[model samples]
Target: MPKPSGRGAADSSYAAGTGIAGRGVLLDVGRYKGSDGPDDSWLPLDANPLEEAEPDAAITLDDLKATADAQGVRLREHDILLIRTGAIERTQDPNAEWDPFGEPGLTYSDDLIEWVHEMDIPYIGADNLAVEQIFQTVTEDDLGEGRKSLHGNYALPLHGAFLRDLGVSLNEVLDLSELAAQCAEDGIYEFLFTAAPLNFEMGTGGPVNPVVLKATDGAGEEGGSEGRRGRGR
Candidate 1:
C-alpha cells in the first residue's frame, strides 16, 4: 500500500514487527459523569436501558493533571497514557447499544492536543471505540468560504494531528476496567507497559493486546515482590 499522508508515513518507529515499551499511566475517566451509561437515543427500540447516571462532562487537560496528582503519579516522557472513559464497560452489557459512530470520549480541541505534545508522551490509548467523539456536524459555514477542510477539520481531529503530524499512535476500543481496578486497589497509577503490533508489512492498523504491569510492593516504589500484568481488551 502507498504510504499514508501523515507523520505515520515518515515515522517507522511504531511500524508493524516493532515493539513499544515504556511507563504507563491510566487516567480513569470512565466513572466520570455522563460516561457511565449508554445514550438512550442510540439504543435499540426493544432494548431496556439503564437510567441516566449523571450530567455530561468533558475531560480537559487540567482534569488529567489533577487526576494524576491525586493519585500521586507524575506524568513523564515516553509514558503511554491510557484514558478509560468507561464506554467499553457499557458495551459489555447485552442490553447496551454499542454505537461506534456516536459515543462519549475525550473532547478534541487544539488545547488538548497541545497538552499531549507538551507532556512528551509517545503513545495514547482509550477505552472508547474512537479516541474522540464522532459524527460532529460541520456545515459549510463552519468551514468558512474558500478554506479547504484539512485532515484535522473532522470530528476526530486529533487522529490526523497525532498520527500524521506528531507521529503518535492511537489505540482504541481498549477494555480498561481491570486496569483501573488494579490501579485503584494498589494505589498505583504508573506501570511498565508493553505492546507489540502484528507483523503486517505495509499495514495501517491491526489488533493488539496491551499489558500494564504493576509492582507488587506498593505505589510509587521501585522494587516489589513481583510484577503483575494487567491485560487489556
Candidate 2:
C-alpha cells in the first residue's frame, strides 16, 4: 500500500505479534544523577543528553553492544531500536511526559551515525521528547579540568538529516523498561516486533504508539518490512 503523508497514519498492517523472540534487553539511557538525595533531575524541555555525561553512568554504546553480543541474537535489520534516556520517567503528567531523558544520554551524532552505518543498525527509537537530552551542561568529571566541549548536541542533525534525509528511520518515546528487564533475564536482545507509523505525508513527524509484543520463536513475518524502510536521502 502507498504510504500516506502530510497528516495521516502509517498503514496498520503489523498491529499484532511476529512470534520470534527469546530475550530482549532494555537499555535505559535516561539521565539521572543516581543520587539518594532529592531527585534534582529536572531539565528544561530542550535539554541535551550528551553535554557532559559520564560514559559509565548511562547506557553507552559499549553496553548496548555487549548486551546484544551476549544474547546470541542479531538485531533485526529493520527493527526499531528503542532508546530510553529516562527523561519522561520523571514527568508527573502523562500527557506532558514528552521529555525523554534527564541529562546523560543523547542520540547519535554524525560520527555516531557513521558508527551506526558500520554496525548496520537499522533504526533508532527513544523515550525522550527529542532523541538527545535537553540541557547541554557538562560536569567536572565528564572532562578533565578545563575542556571546553566534550560532545556536541548533534541529535537533530543525525535524526533530521542522517536518519530522515539518509533514509533511516527513528522512533521516539518508546517505553522499554519491561523489555530491558526481559532481555536481562533471557539473554535475548532481539525480538520479532512490529510498529505502525503515523502516515502523515505532509507532516514532519507523526504520533506513534508502538507496541513491543513478546514472541516465542520465529513467528516473525516477512510482512511489515516496508515501514521499516524510510523515504529520505
Say which candidate scores most in TM-score. Answer: 1
Candidate 1, 1-233: lDDT as tens digits: 97655333434334545687888888865533333354321212112112231113345566677767777888887788988776666677787656665565555555667767887777888877666655333234334346435213255666676877777778887777766766766777787877876654445566766766676445474432222222221
User: Candidate 2 deviates by what RMSD?
Assistant: 9.2
Our model 1 lands, by Cα RMSD against the true structure, at 7.1
Where does candidate 1 clash, by residue pair? Answer: 7-164, 30-85, 30-86
* TM-score per candidate: 0.71, 0.54
Task: State which candidate has the highest lDDT.
Answer: 1
User: In model 2, how large is the Cα lDDT of residue 151?
Assistant: 43
lDDT of 2: 0.44
Q: How close is candidate 2 to the true structure, as a TM-score?
A: 0.54
- lDDT measured at residue 101 in model 2 versus the true structure, 0 to 100: 45
lDDT for 28 (candidate 2): 38
lDDT tens digits, residues 1-233, model 2? 99654423322222212212222234433322232112432233433345544443344445455545545555544344655444445454555434334533453434455556665555566655555444443333334435435543433445544444444555555555555545445544555444545544445555555545553333443221122222211
